[model samples]
Target: MLKNNKSDYMNWIILIGVFVLLLEVLFFNRGVIFSLFISAGMIYLGRKKSAKKKGKILFWGGIVFLCASVFNMMTFKFFLLAILLHFFIKYTSSKKNPNRVSPVLVEPEITKQEETVVVSKPLLDNTIFGQQKTPTGVYEWDDVNIQAGIGDTVIDLSYTVFPKGETVIFIRNIIGNIHILVPYDIEVSVHHSVIAGTTTMLDFHQPKIFNKAFHLKTPGYDHAEQKVKIFTSLVVGNLEVGRI
Candidate 1:
């Protein structure tokens, strides 16, 4: 049954791909295929003859042509339409459900008093495009857990003192590197995963890793009282953990 389902899924994908190609040829730009091939040839030739002035022109021209071809394709039109349709549906849904009931509203008999509380800012704030580093001077120790869109994360354990038990540092990045500096006294355990990158944890070095997970640890990590446990994942990047 699973094999049949898989075959059906593949068939559907092939059919959809063929249909899209047919649409591109018949209804949309017919020369897009040729344009892409030409662009690729131009780019290859340009790289081969990179020292000459004509190579520079070919490189830039190929880039421009590729962009033009992509933008004029049926797929791009579908992408734009999908974006517009998504926004339109979202706006309509928001307008219709303006007074959506919360979980608290469902429990009518339970009355609770509202209390004011102070919220402290986290040490490693989430960012899209910037480095997240530990403070240089003396600062309170906090468990680092942040999701970054595209940036390097640097955590230095030398500045702040760690509490007893396991100190966790969890980081998730779409496209960035993770570098952690740990003191020699502190035992460390790392669980790092990457889609396409490398890992350099202490003396261990994985030059080219793809879609793999690594579990590394100091010999004393299991029994150390003030040890740090790092969990990091990246879509396309590197991981490096070393002694400070």
Candidate 2:
């Protein structure tokens, strides 16, 4: 009952606080927005003219104006008051409630039981600077997720058999090329993020891509039971997702 009452009071306090902030922003602090923009412009002009006397004046004037405008706002004053009140309450509560030893603190720690289970490793291992490729022959299928520093990754899905449901492959490389070959029958979804690279996915080709994110999916990807979802992130590299 006490906790519930406290929670209810907290909710009311939050709602009232929000209402007060809205009122301050709409009525009292209406000019703060315009003042902020003017301050920013003044700062920019000041920096551009910093080599001369006018630039320095503009910069210092903008800084002083921004500080004064921000400090004069009711919202800023309220925030400062709230922070001070919170610290005061916390300090008084700590002083009133002295720490006492409890059974939980003095109780002995229990030993945790250990059990070992064998787990198979993924086909693609993370490397710093090297080429990562799936074996040419038949290999057991495992979800591929690896992060590398500088390496080229090539995964041929044609050789391996995918299990039922969606198969996920995530690869993040700092500076490397990624190439994945998918079967024609399998529905594939590719989401790639690259800073600077060339992307070639099926028939769609991007010769030059800089700071771009691409999402491509087959037509029947939504309903397909067996589909591959590939997510690759590269800083400076090339990505190729071709149908075999």
Each prediction's Cα lDDT score?
Answer: 0.83, 0.84
* Deviation of model 2 at 230, angstroms: 0.2
Over 1-244, each residue of candidate 1 has an lDDT whose tens digit, in order, gives: 9589757856765566568878888777788878986875575466546679998698668778878998877777665665676589769978998976756546468788999999988999989876778888988998988999756788888899899999999999976678999999999999998876789999999976868999999999998999999999986678999998
For lDDT, the strongest prediction is 2
| Leading candidate by TM-score | 1
TM-score of each: 0.58, 0.55
Q: lDDT per residue, candidate 2, 91-128, as tens digits?
A: 89779997787666555598778899999887988899
Candidate 2, overall lDDT? 0.84
Name the regions of candidate 1 deviating beyond 4 angstroms: 1-116
CA error at residue 80 for candidate 1, angstroms: 12
* Each prediction's number of clashing residue pairs: 0, 0
